[model samples]
Target: MTYKYQLIFLGDINNNACNTIKVRFFDKIHSIGLRDNMFEIIYNETFERKYSNKQPSFVFYFGNLNHSEKDIDILKVLLDNGDAILPIYFGDNFEAEVPKIIHVMNGRQYIADHIEKYINYAFESMRLLRENRKLFISYRRTDSSAVANQLFDAFVRNNYDVFLDTYSINPAKNFQEELHHRMTDCDVLIQLYTNDFKNSKWCNEEIISANQKQIGVVEIIWPDCTPDIHNLLCEPIQLTQKMFMNEDFHNGSCCITEECIENIVNAVESVRARNLAARQDNLVGEFVEEARKQGRQLIQEYRYLVETLKDDIIRLFIPAIGIPQSYDCFDSLRFRKLLDNEKIELFLIYDDLRIRKKWVEHLEWLNESLEVKTIKKKDFELWLKNN
Candidate 1:
């Protein structure tokens, strides 16, 4: 559903040298474990999609400085939009115009075949800059260290990036800033509930922060004690005695036994699923706003599964506004281009396909991997609601 980057190649399609560069760049991309279909080659396409959390990294590849006027304009627009650009150039045509801060790869050695290595390095750099999925531990360190340590080990073994204050904090970092970062950035917070949990200054702060940020919280009720819920934390999962090794706490040394690990896993999964749904909601709103900005009339869109194995894909249609000169406008161009740039396949409905056959053909041709369905306008609202 989300990727680390949307690798976009932006250069002069007419440049004779770029053919080898394109082939080798794609070869290297696949070789580095990046999927080819995920990458966008913006040759004749317009820049339409907004760079957001789903596609956080917007990478651009400009082959040479000998770009067309339109290509130069697009490059400027990309720079303005804050997308990362990799300008592969050898000559001094637009070198002075290029910003000193932009990411540029040397193309003089294309004959030498080292462009792929530099491209790989740039992509790796982009990936390293992305924030990793994290889980934060909120516990009373002095009282719950034993259980926290075990949970930490379990999470690590399960391949979760965890932020336990005792293990995560560094001496050189500012305590407040680092703690805030961890609390806000984490996907889930496992609150190891103890008698001292609400009393600790740090624990209380962590709970409030998690609540304010809307981060998911799993309450692991140690010794089966009820934490005072005056200041409500996020929906909590209470682990009972049957879920653990023992209810007997001879100075708080108990182990999680039977179904408790699964309980924690299920809670995390639920939170993740909810988060994914929320993200889709946000994306739907964004796509609608984008379409409206281009003055296209939205018939309907469905947020439903295209396949059980894949995440939900949106299907929307923009019909002709019924004006005589509607065909000459960027309304359709802007609408379809936005979808194409994002590689989103949706059910498109129209008054007549013959009116925009060329554009429809281009859209279908470009995204051969995507499945498209044509529907009547009468089914729009019903499809949206049911989906």
Candidate 2:
């Protein structure tokens, strides 16, 4: 996807030079289907004001020997800070040689192609930098402003680029749009819940938005109240008003306090840690399931191979015996133990050779035993006849 980027062009190009650069950029942007709004161009004259206004994704400087030393120094500062600098020298001069500067030929296509590549690189770098430092805090003003202010101050003190509606964005503007943009750009959202918090549509909407965005939400509870908060949050941090007023809030310590402010900070940190752990666990579980499936498939294939070998062994060996006679080896005591273990008092069977031989002894034993008072065995046909 093509992302919007602010491009600031520096250097002292004359009227002809300016026209040439503008036409070149316009043609390139049009060719690539990019609108004028996608990029911004600034000269050295309006550099400071524009730079202070908005953060740019990429910077291009086109300078030559005719430029003043002060302008060269300013460009050097930008270059030293790792801003992408593209210089278009009027004539061949080795004096302004710098490893950071990319020499561009005075052609539309060449400038367009090089600028596009540089812009992409700059964008990717910005993305990585932004992903590393992102934090968002969500709180209801009706619940506790003091706690919210303290939390915002703590984050600011810690050098975190915190996005809390209380202080981050301009309150005078369209708040809903601003809030949506801030929440979407944030990596984590800290939610402070009070007794009356669930009743507010704005708070509920913020929570839902954070959840939908897959941003981490840490729910902090107000002191001395349990107002159906569980329905809104799976894991909420319980705290009280006294806990928030303590010195722990100032030091950025998450000591599991009952105060709302301390609890909020602690809960936010805990949720962040938990989210990281869950992501790792999910990755590990996926790998384990894949390995298990592979193992099961291997086992199935091995079993098939073994059965095939067994059939081959049987076919090669069984034919030599012509017709095999089946033999029965009975263990009376083991069979009796099995029956006793199963809690079965009697077993019925046909009048076989072994049954006939042991019939008198078995009857005598049963007559003397309390557990088994009788024993009977009959053929399937004979049992039907008797019934």
Candidate 3:
């Protein structure tokens, strides 16, 4: 079976910090409600067996290795295979602890309190979270307007490109259409789940649309309201009176405390990785399903997934969550360079749902001379039928 994500730990197996990191890693995963299929954590003991079956997607080397030559060979193989390895040290001396092979790459000095950052970067390295972060604030106006405004400010302060309907939508634009369009480009939906959230037609559809697009959701639920059942994989953060700055929740206002906002942001970061993987899976599955309808044999490989054809040609489809950027093309070019200079066609598979027409035209213009083209979700079936 093709796993969506894989993380492996190597080096200092007996370190207390490693144990601490492992415990918290699983806790973080559970806390965020990451789907079981989203990732698997392979330990040192089972490394060989697991590595034999499936290669590691990301590796955290705990540092200062006195490991056997055989294990070193395995690490070398991982490097040769282009797997991402992060050397983590605790003794302040990276060269003293990490082997010379990893010397060329930058190593991180492990901090006791920075496990969250480590895990977050691991996801980024795996292409689960794009470097540019953007989110949509989904809430019922009458129920969470105040809280929504507070979060918008907080997210903006944190350098996020957050989308709030009231502030984002222009004066003359088609409200519903523009709302839907902006949502297509957001990485996650921060839902302020109040008592009357479901009562609002637009609010209801925002959450539903987020799920349909396979975007992550961080639901901050009110004390009296039960968490919405739409996102089965998200463990909602239940709110209490203590979390409110005003110490009172009203029909149209909830000013959550600073601490609560921080927790919510962390929760969103955690969910972001898994949701990106899920979206890629959705896009790849849809494309492959379309291809199979016409009896085209496709195999899954590469960053998102790749397939080889009968004409000695390789097609690499990298899922472009939100918007496909210049970096996506550059990264794909880097990956392409790692392989033989074989006949290859690179593509960025994405959803065109509500994406701005101007950006779409820009992408089309970029495709004329650019070697890496794009395939939109809306055109998947037709793309297959014609291609």
Best by lDDT: 3
- Candidate 2, residues 187-216, lDDT tens digits: the string is 457666665565678667766666554456
lDDT against true structure, model 1: 0.49
Best-to-worst TM-score order = 3, 1, 2
Model 2 bad stretches (over 4 Å): 1-131, 227-234, 246-266, 274-387
Per-candidate TM-scores read 0.41, 0.34, 0.61
Cα error, candidate 1, residue 91 (Å): 39
lDDT for residue 325 in candidate 2, whole number 0-100: 12
What is the C-alpha local distance difference test score of each model? 0.49, 0.43, 0.70
Residue 86 lDDT (model 2): 42
Query: Which should have the higher TM-score, number 1 or number 3?
Result: 3
RMSD of each: 19.2, 31.9, 9.1
TM-score, model 3 to reference: 0.61
Off by over 4 Å in 1: 1-132, 230-233, 241-246, 250-253, 279-387
